[model samples]
Target: MALDVGMFEGHRVNRAAAERRCATLTTRRSVKKAHQAAWLVNAVRCVDLTTLAGDDTEGRVKRLCAKARKPLASHIEAGLGLSAGELTVGAVCVYPTMVPHAVKALEGSNIPVASVATGFPAGLMPLHLRLEEIRWAVAQGAAEIDIVINRELALTRNWQGLHDEIAAMREACGDAHMKAILATGELETLNNVYSASMVAMQAGADFIKTSTGKESVNATLPVSLTMLRALRDYGMATGHRIGFKPAGGMKQAKEALAWQILMKEELGRDWLNPDLFRFGASSMLGDIERQLEHYVTGRYADSSRHALA
Candidate 1:
């Protein structure tokens, strides 16, 4: 995780090969029956159920927390060999201002509250204020902070600046684990994505994430594969395990399994856990719940059955 400024210089991605591989990863073999049910349960465990809307409210945050707590409904939980207090999501993510509501709702539970900080989705604020926001969220009981990297730094080829910025954000995060959102859609090229990923990890990001879910093009398979390569490289170079989160536009149970398979293939089985991997998603749980219902009961349930509220 050294500040290898030129680390991304010579890396070449054969788009065809990468695309083919990603396609294969998702389509080669679908997990089914009890195994599919298990994978769905794992998907539930790896989700960072998020709400980053402008209209977010305390009541919305409470419902989100409640969903994170049980994820699967009571009867569904029992049918899947799980019980109350079991099968919760990895964490619940919300805006910095909503951290307190989420924390209060999730109090006494092991579920961690992750706050999006540093101006979030767009890190354009003064660096000082962004740092203060991180402190504010942590003070509100946020155990994890997902900070967006200034895309302009990568857009303008200021690798050093991007690295330092993430480092500062990581420092501001203090004890809360920091997830560096690269916003890959705006990076425009796999090369830039790789460079940004390297710089973020070099600066001590606990996880290098793919998007903000606000981008027009968020978290595509090829972009995700590129980032996974960077994660694997960072781990090998530093002997420290770093996490990877593919956020945005992944809403189906099948889609979650695809990403999980990609992780398993590229980073090994250890990356399948909540500690090393997460899907930053808001609507994916509903689909997974639907699929699980089909698996366990042989009846396809409506997505409405697992509504967030």
Candidate 2:
């Protein structure tokens, strides 16, 4: 699909309405006991188990890969009647240089390695260099590439410029899937968020991500609702579905349930899978693991028991 300003231009989002809708998504819909456990497990499958810290090391990435491989402990899996190695996160996300470590660590498993490229977190580098970064990550065996869009372009409403740059990055990704980070917090208005999401999808983004996990505000429900509206509109007109990922500041199993509920209600069960949704989280898994342990034994385990993730 080519860039089409007609799709999102002049689009307006009412913040109050969006906030009200997000509010009901949690209070009105509730999953308890077994149903809650099931949704949490689904959330585990959609997690992009990530380690993007500046102090990231090969050892750390491998450990994260190990967690991704066996997200649920054997005791918990047995209690749930799940087989060994039956559960795994959607992908292992790391810095570009750490992709090889994750790729090797996750070998012989179905999980894919994801790398944050295109000068991630800031994306302030020159365009040519950013394109090269994508190529380099793909060569390093990253099956998925997360690239941040230039906030300046979106802020100034330079749709053509934004589209061209993302298209170039997509070309550089080659065979790898691309998740375009909209950095919604910096985009100011919900209108800007919708327009940017539309532009990213039009430029061939396989997923429209909410943030890079670095912004002061990241992955708020109101902003995510706006992006999903754009995603739904795009799907309606073009019949091509795109994924959604909410990254940063999510650290509870209940938060996982909330987002999954949002996806199921707004986009149906189709978006409930890894192909259409992802949680770019690192610590959130710890809480989920703890909750599952509690569900199995009727006692909450110490946070340290599930702290590895």
TM-score of every candidate relative to the true structure = 0.98, 0.99
Best by lDDT: 2
Q: Which candidate leads the pack in TM-score?
A: 2
Model 2 residue 239 lDDT score: 95
lDDT of each: 0.90, 0.93
Predicted candidate 2 versus true structure: per-residue lDDT over 1-309, tens digit per residue: 688899988788999999999998888866899999999999999999999899999899888999999998899999988999999999999999999999999999999999999999999999999999999999989999999999999999999999999999999999999999999889999999999999999999999999999999999899998999999999999999999999989999999998998888889999999999999998999999999998889999998988664
Instruction: State model 2's lDDT.
Output: 0.93
Query: Worst lDDT window (10 residues) for model 2?
Result: 300-309
With candidate 1 superimposed using the best TM-score fit, by how many Å does residue 271's alpha carbon deviate from the native? Answer: 0.3
Q: lDDT of model 1 at residue 8?
A: 70
